[model samples]
Target: MPFFVYGTLRPGEHNHDRFVRGRDVRAQPAFLHGGALYDGPGHPFATDGDGTVRGALLTAAPAEYPGLLVALDRLETYLGPGDPRNLYERVVRPVEVPGSGTVRAWVYLAAPAVTRTLRANGPRIPGGDWLSHRPPRTDRLLPPPGPRTP
Candidate 1:
């Protein structure tokens, strides 16, 4: 099954380069209905809800699917269903793929505890799109101000 990724794993994001690039057979714009996105420490967390979340649907290359799945599971801290240490839970969710209608895809949603906390106090991403809602980078490396002419 394709994976619906809304956060770091989306195209051009850091994790996309590290974990998804070259491994996906195809990546296309998709949306998850009945969901919400919230700002996490350095990424974003999705929770099941009434909002719509914009994302990408990634179909893994057949040769890469097995490894990719394991890598993603590790990356998301998912350790099977109902694991106490999981940050996300891998589950099948209906993702609306452009021109293809809705299809069931793997989505990593915030674990139960994380969802509860996020609902209680986390900052919800207003637009439910992490790419557009992420905070500005404060750590960008500049070229030392062009040698600082005296």
Candidate 2:
């Protein structure tokens, strides 16, 4: 199955060049329904919800599929099904590809523990589009403009 990438794994993101570049047969815009995106430490996490998450469906080259699967599992910290240490759980979900119909693809979603935490405190990414989502600023606030120095 193709992988549905919704966060850093999407094209032009930091992880894309390192993990997905040259390994995919095609990467196209896709959407996953009944899901929501939440801001993670540096990336974004998808969880089961009522909203739609925007991402890409990446069909890996036949020769690269096996390795790509292993790599993605490791990157997402998915040790196995129901593993306590897993941050994300890999599951097959239906993704809608533009021009094409819906296809079942591998999707990484926040694990139960992570989802609980996210529900309690994590900020949801508006519009569920990680590529266009900008995290809120964390920089210290500055005082109102004082008299300009010469």
Candidate 3:
């Protein structure tokens, strides 16, 4: 599955090699529309917008998700179903990749408030390039989205 990653977790950034693994992994510059980029304490998050936000389109083997999850957060540190960690929350958001049809790939988006707060305090990593190198922590973490229920 292809995962959209932005922040300090993108390839060749401060945190890429620790998370991205496997011979089947591939990455390319991609984007997501309808969002605004905001800086955080140690990362950045896109809020509601109409223009495309810069990021990466990660093509990985079906088995690579698990490894990526581990690098995202810590097991048993938050919850189950995936791993229990406080790195990112998984969701299926619409992404607009140039020359490619709209596709819904799994993306780990940072919480808006936390990401924004981080940005106000210090310098941001700038797009997905800086994201590839930061390690995730247990601070104010989240999980993948679940089905909407009444």
In candidate 3 the C-alpha lDDT for residue 51 amounts to 49
lDDT of 3 by residue, 91-133 (tens): 6787767788677876665444444554566344434334443
The TM-score ranking, best first, is 1, 2, 3
Candidate 3 residue-wise lDDT at 93: 86
For candidate 3, what is the TM-score? 0.61
The runs of at least 3 residues in candidate 2 whose Cα sits more than 4 Å from the true structure, single-residue gaps closed, are: 135-150
Task: Write down the worst ten-residue block by lDDT for model 1.
Answer: 137-146
TM-score of each: 0.90, 0.88, 0.61
> What is candidate 1's lDDT per residue for 1-150, written digit by digit as tens?
999999989988889888988765589999999999999999999999989999999998888999999999999999999999999999999999989999999999999999999999999998799988886644444455555668
Q: Per-residue CA lDDT of candidate 2, range 1-150, in tens?
A: 999999888887768878988775589999999999999999999999999999999998889999999999999999999899999999999999989999999999999999999989999998999878855434325666679979
RMSD (Cα, Å) of model 3: 13.6
After TM-score superposition, the amount by which residue 114's alpha carbon in candidate 2 deviates from its true location, in angstroms, is 0.1
Span of 10 residues, lowest total lDDT, candidate 2: 134-143
The positional error of residue 109 in candidate 2, measured at the CA in angstroms, is 0.1
**Regions of model 1 farther than 4 Å from truth:** 136-150
